[model samples]
Target: MAPSVLIVGAGPAGLILAIILRQNGIAVRIIDKEPTYRPGSRGSGIQPRTLELYDILGVLPAIREVGEFVPPMARYEPGKIEPTSTARLGEWVDPTPDVPYSNALSLSQDEHEEILRTHLQTLSCSVELGSELRKFEHFSDRVVAHIFKTDSDGNEVEETTTFGWLVGTDGAHSVVRKQLGLSFLGETRTEQQIALGDIIVEEGVKLNLWHMWSVPPKLIALRSGGATSKKFMFAYTGRPEHIADKTITRDEFIQDFYAITGRHDVKFGPTSWLSNYRPNLRMVDKMRDGRVLIAGDAAHCHSPTGGQGLNSSVQDAANLGWKLALVQKGLAAPALLDSYGEERLRVIAQMLQLTTDLFHKTFASLHSADKSDDSGWKRGGDLAMLGVNYCGSSIIQEEPDAVAGSAYMEAEGGRVQAGYRAPDAPGLIHSGTPTTLFTIFNTASHTVLLFGGDLEAVGKFPQGAVRVVEVLPQGHSVGALAGSALVAEDREGHAYTGYKLQSDGFTVVMVRPDGVVGAVAHDTEGVERYFQKIFI
Candidate 1:
């Protein structure tokens, strides 16, 4: 019998989860309360890490076709632009050409979701929009869900299904979270924010960089869309009266825009979508109970300071999706699922802390008086994107040669530590395909990184279960000759640095499907032991 998984919410998290599960041969059914896709530009920036993940999922090109790259820029005040943080777009994709997407692309959330949906449609799994889950009953063996849906004519109907597990990828106000009786414990910032619609900007005003204006009572952000469209997000200190009425006129929006930009000659065009949102820094106490799990905003919601919410959600789905698929197929033990909460919770907590700090810094800049020391503000802004780290989790290994263990010490933790995504190595190859370590390493159920040794000894494992690659000396490694590769030479003359082997023999580092280090062993004898411990 095939195991079935139920996912609530059709947003990015849910949709991406469905695609991954389906790709892994798992049966998935996704439900969403909304009848149709939401319009307008909600989040317009996709980080470099996300682009890397999309490449692994084989959808990077599709996303890039509709997306734009945002050149980094610093804005001290409205219309006052300062040149800062700039990278050759896509350089981070692989640090090598054989890899897919190496750069961050800017596209509206609507376009991103549409591309994901199109990919999902190619699979057997699909999202059931307009269908809302009324309640769920968890049994010892199976979980039953009651779904209430409204038809095209607005007729109500009910349906029921049983599944092996249920995942909540719904937004912050997730009904799935509500039904589970989970406590969302955190503080909601007292400030209110208004993120306006996707509108066209007048010609001659450059829309290539993100325009930020630090003004009292509000910090306004103008984000450029792919090619032509433009959108603005306004974070105001006080809650305006009648904001909940949803009847804000275009004239009022224009006035606010002018006040933020301090430019009266600017004209506003039609808005495609408009909404007021109160930023909340919150996370559920637990991400899983019994056979139920949660992802995305349903489990955690943070300020849009680092633009990490969507990326974090997608990553959560990526982690849980493959595990659920393997468990359903009886390829791994149920204990593997426990690592999900243990691993993701650590990440969520870190993101919350970083985002909270970002909120304070961004808002503080907004409230500061003229000529105030902007050094602190500038440092905070720069650190926002480089502050995420995943350490001290069940899945990541504590490598001896690992760098500082603190989350703040490095962005996303040092690649060699536990709970961290293995860093890319330049000029690595797999199956005659020219690619980086990330491309070869990310294609398996678990990643087995062999530092420096012959591959024959480690080739006994199940095919495709682990990826085996050789990290050669700098001058000898293929990356050196590949011209485009970013391979580095350390004191040992190795093609890479930062990873430590526990022993001289075949050291096997098993990275969980979610990109976390699951277990480590120095010899083949430790394989069964590691498996037994994780299989339950």
Candidate 2:
């Protein structure tokens, strides 16, 4: 099939976008520059907000299988490897009725990408490896791109293709970003250089917890790979001038490990991969330009502090996927794509500041004399990214009546309103069958939820674009409402409670495909108007 959407860079963001678009029956061609899959343990933190998206995309179960909760970090005292203090890097939080995924997980980006790739394959789409987007030409109605790929003989071949839209997930040094002339404004921290690598440790090493050696002027942290992972991911940061030669051999790596930890019992083995990196804090001015757009690291780049980079990048793809699919299918106006950047830019800017601040704090803690609670690895609900919202977006319509009850609920002190992350509700019995909010949210399509409203009201909304689901009180009957559009009984009132809908009153809520509340209305009367702003 000829692809309507061309996605460059098959990282987690690009893979997710392709999966969503293909699941919606939109043709997608995803390409990656790297000849093979990325091999690294970087960007391993999976925030809670991202896990919700994975649930919507039908890949949560696989992701959870390869993921694990963050372990506690042991800070060893100077000159003594045995005596030290320990603190939780991130404590596991119990799930609530409103939020099912309450905490983040530690999973390698490579593994996460494989999960997305597998899901995309289920929809009959596969990423093209050894493919790179050379350039793109924007036309009035479509964009044409020239892609470079190698054949079996390793000969370069250039192919031209036309697409309804294009998205760049091509990392910080994005070819599409450069070709579009979008300015990436930010700075690089040269002084905060870090030597990072994945290494296999000897037997009998404690594998569940992270070990940190924060001797003054030098910091080395060995974080757990995952639940079943045998390799530990390590990083070194502080003084780069110490290694003047800058050549790190296996012996040198082991020597440095002992010097930092001051322990002779622990043994370090061969390293799988090694890299010296400096964090780049930068972002493009905007996300869209004419027929071409950008998402993920191509649009924004930040320090890995708080583990926000990978999660934020995938969230960007999730936010953009449904909008592009809607527009391409003519269900939504082309201008509807404008909200993609309007909704995400502010959140990304806020994320940059938060991560940068944490990075500096960690840098300061490593150089400070007083080793208090300044380890800077204190990730909490704030890092979960569940608080991101699009209240300022024009497409998110909030009725005045909805402002009273449901919209006022706090998620980590942040309001859950129209344009905020939609909360999950449990114990919904639809036609005598038990279900939850997540079961029906698997598709990248608008979900219309009617609380105590007639099924006839669903006809007022768009047919193919909106999926109307009714939630009524127990013992209430809506027999054959609009020919079986799915009616649910709030047996435990968990649906009403989780959504914070007012009792004894009817309400209609529309959730965006990306798992955010797009609109809330007291009745179906405003549903048409709310969708008019979204669809053509």
Q: Which stretches of candidate 2 lie over 4 Å from their true place?
A: 78-83, 242-247, 399-416, 455-457, 475-478
Top TM-score hit: 2
- Collision pairs in model 1: 90-102, 90-103, 93-102, 388-412, 395-517, 396-418, 396-419, 397-418
Model 2 lDDT tens row, 274-376: 8887789998888999779999999998988898888888888888888888888888888988998987887888889888988888887877777776557
Alpha-carbon runs more than 4 Å astray in model 1? 1-3, 72-104, 230-247, 259-262, 371-390, 397-404, 407-415, 429-432, 442-444, 451-464, 467-507
What are the Cα lDDT values of the candidates?
Answer: 0.64, 0.80
Error of 2 at 388 (Å): 0.7
* Model 2 / residue 333 / CA error / Å: 1.4
Any residue pairs clashing in model 2, and if so which? none
How does candidate 2 fare on TM-score? 0.94
**Worst 10 contiguous positions by lDDT, candidate 2:** 403-412
Q: RMSD, each candidate, Å?
A: 5.7, 2.7
